[model samples]
Target chain A: MKKRTILGVRACTWVWLIMMGLTLVTYLIGQLGLGGISASLTVLAFALIKGQMLGDYFMGLKRISGFWRWPVVIWLFLPGGLISVAFTLVG
Target chain B: MQAQAVAEPIRYPPGDLAIWVFILAELAAFGAFFGAYAFTRMQHVELFNHFQATLDRDAALINTFALITSSYFVVRAVASIRDNNSQGCVRWLMAALVMGALFLIVKAQEYAHHIDEGIRLSTNTFYMFYLSLTFFHFMHVIMGMVILAAVAVKAKRGGYSATEHTGVETGASYWHMVDLVWLILFPLVYVMK
Candidate 1:
C-alpha cells in the first residue's frame, strides 16, 4: 500500500466514527421533543455539520486547497438557512 | 535580466469535475424542494404538524443509521481501491450495497404501509411533501446502488488501480451525496417539531 493511501484510510475512519456519533446525538436531541424554534435550529445545525463532514472527508474536498471548497460550504448553508427561517416564522 | 517563474496551484476537485456539477444541480433541486416544504408548512402549520405526527420516526431513525453506515462502507471501499486492492474494494463495496438494499427494503415497507393506509400524494400538503421528498430520495438511493454495483464489478475485474481509480471515487461521491440529502431530509421532514 502506498503511504498516502494508508493515511487516507486512517483519516476517513476517524471521520466516519465522528459522523455516526453525531447522528446518534441528533436523534436523541429530536427525541427530547424540544419543539418549536430551538429544536428546528439545532437539528439544522446538526444536518449542516454532518453534510460538511461528508463533503470534506468522504468527498475529499478537504484535500483540495482552492476555490472548490466554497461551493460545498455554500450548498450547505443555503438550504439550511432557508429551513431555519421557515421554522422560525412558523413558530 | 531573467524572467521570473511562478508555481501553479496544487489542488484539484475529486472524482471528476462533471460529477461535481451534477452534484451541485442535485443539491440545488433538493434545496428548492426543502424551501418549498418549509414555506408550505408555514402556511399550513396545523395541518403539517398534525400529519407530521403521523410519520414513523422510528423507521426514519433506522434509515438514518443505515445510510450513515453505508457511507462509511463506501469510504472504506474507496480506501481499498486507493491501495490497489481490487478484491478488498469489491468486498467493501458489496457490503455498502447490502446496506443500501436494506435501506430500500425498509423504505419500501414504509411506502407499503402508507399505501395500505390510503395515503396518496394528494392526501394532504404534509403527506404530499413527505411522499414526494422521501420517494425522490428513495429513487436516488437505488440509483446510487447501481453506480456502486458497477464500480464494484469493474473493481472485481481488475479495472481499477491505485493510479487510476477515478471510477470508484465518482461512485462514492454520488453515494455520499445521497447520504447527505438524507441527513438533511430526515430532520426536516421526520424529526422537526
Candidate 2:
C-alpha cells in the first residue's frame, strides 16, 4: 500500500507516460520523413532524455550521490555525442 | 554543501552493486557497437538510407512501445515488492514477460519477412549489421525474460519482503538496461536518417 507518489500519481507512472510520449514524438518524426541535422538532433535529444529518465527513475539512480550516477549519464552521452557527430558528417 | 551531504545518508542504489557494474560493462559494449554503426553509415549514407527504408518502422515502433511498457511494468513490480506486495509484484513481472514475448513475436515476423526476401548476413553490409546487432539484442531480451521469470517465481513463493527484495531489483535493473539500450537502438538503427 506504499507508493512513491509525485503530484498525486506514482513517480514511475509519470516517468512511463512521459517515455511513451517521447516515443510517439520520435515515431512521428520518422513517419513524417524528417531528416537532417535538426531532425537528427531532435531524435537524439529525445533518446538521451528517455535514457536518462530510465536510469534515474526506473533504475533508481537519481538519489544516490558520487560515482554511481555517473556511469549511466556518461555511457549515454559519450556514445550519443559520437553518434551525433557521425550523423552530422552525412553531408 | 558538506553539511547537507552529510545530513542525507549515502545510500547505495536499490539493486546489487555488481549488477550495476555489469550493466555499465554491457553499456560500454553496446556503446561501441552503436558508435561503429553510426560511423559505418557515414561511408554509405545512401545505401544505409535506402535499406533503412526497407525496414519495418511500424514493427520497430511497436517493439519500442513493448519494451518501454515492459520496463514500466518491471518498475511497478519493483515498487510492489518495496511495499511487500508479493502477489502484485508477481503480477507485474508476468505482465512484463508478456510484453517481452510480444517483442520477440513481432521481431520474429520481421525476420521471417527478411528471410523470405532472401536476406542473409551476406546479403549486404547493412543487412549484416542489422541482423547481427538485432539478433544479439534479441538474445538479451530472451535472457531478460528468463531472469524476470525466475524472480517472479521466487516472488510468488513469498521469498521476498519489503526489506529483502534485492532479487527483484536486480532483475528489474537488468530489464531496464535492456530497455535503455533499445531507446537508443530504435532511433539509431530504425528511425535516424
Candidate 3:
C-alpha cells in the first residue's frame, strides 16, 4: 500500500476543532454538577472518543495490521473495567 | 538488502513486539493502581468528591490538550520521515518535545498549587493515589521527551529513510502510548466528580 503523506493543515484543523468540542462538552458537564454516574459516564465517553482520535490519527494505528491493532484496543478497556468494578464494590 | 533474500517470512520486528509486551505489563500495573483507587473511592465517595473539587481542572485540561497535540506532532514526524523530509521530521519531533516540556512545567505549577493548599500526597488516601499516579505519569512524559530528543538528533543527522525509519516509528509509538495513558488518567483524576 502506498503510504499517504502527513495530513495537511486543513485536516489537522478539523481534528483540532473536534477535539476542542469534546473538551468543551466535558467542561460543561463538569460545571453542571451532574453527580457521579452521569459525570463518570460522560467523562468515559469523551475519553474513548479522544482515545480513538489519538489512536487513528496521531498513532497511525489505522494502517497497521490487525495483529497489532486488536491488542491496543483491548488494553484500553482494562482500566475502564477495573475502575468500574472499584466504583461498584466501593461506592 | 541481502537479508531480504533469505525470505524468512518477515515478521513485525521482535523488538517492537517486545516493547508492546512491556507496555502491556505496565498497563497491568496501572490497572492494579486504578483498582485500588476505585476501591478506596467507593468507600469514601464524599472524600473523593471533595478531593476532586480541590484539583485544578483547568490546568489538567490544558495539560491534556498539550499532550494530545504533541502526540499529533509525533505522528507527523513519523510521516515526514517516511516521506523522506528529514528536516520536517526533525521539526515535528522538536515540537513534540517542546509540548511535552510545557506539560511538565504546567504540572509542576499545579503540584505547587496543590501543596500550597495543604493537599500533600499524605493528606489522605485520595491525595496519595492522585499524587502517586500523576507523578508516575509525569515520569513517563519525561522519558518520552528524552526519546523524542534522541529521534530529533538522529533525524538531523539524516539517519532515517523511507524504508528504514523504524527508530522514528518506535519513538512515536512510545510517545503515543504516553498520551494514551494520560487520556484515561485525565478523566479519572479530574472529571470523576
Q: Which of the numbered candidates is closest to the native, going by highest lDDT?
A: 2
TM-score of chain B of each: 0.94, 0.95, 0.90
Question: What CAPRI class is candidate 1?
Answer: medium
Q: Please identify model 3 stretches exceeding 4 Å from their true place.
A: A1-16, A88-91, B1-15
lDDT of 1 by residue, B97-155 (tens): 99999999989999999999999999988998999999999999999999999999999
Q: Fnat for model 1? A: 0.72
Q: Rank the candidates by lDDT, best first.
A: 2, 1, 3
Candidate 3: tens digits of C-alpha lDDT, residues A1-91: 2643346444554665677678767766766766566568667778877777777666666556647665557666776777766654543
lDDT of 3 at B79: 74
Which has the greatest DockQ?
Answer: 2
- Give the share of true interchain contacts found in each model: 0.72, 0.75, 0.45
Model 1 TM-score (2 dp) = 0.92
- What C-alpha lDDT, on a 0 to 100 scale, does residue A52 get in candidate 2? 97
User: lDDT by residue for model 3 over B62-152, one digit each (tens)?
Assistant: 8988987888788778878888999999999999898999999999999888888878778898899999999998998998899889989
Q: Would you give the TM-score of chain B in model 2?
A: 0.95
Error of 3 at A40 (Å): 1.3
Model 2: per-residue lDDT, tens digit, A7-80? 89988899999999999999999989898889988999999999999999988889878878688999999999
User: Superposing every Cα of model 2 onto the true structure, what RMSD results?
Assistant: 2.7
Candidate 1, B1: how far from true, in Å?
26
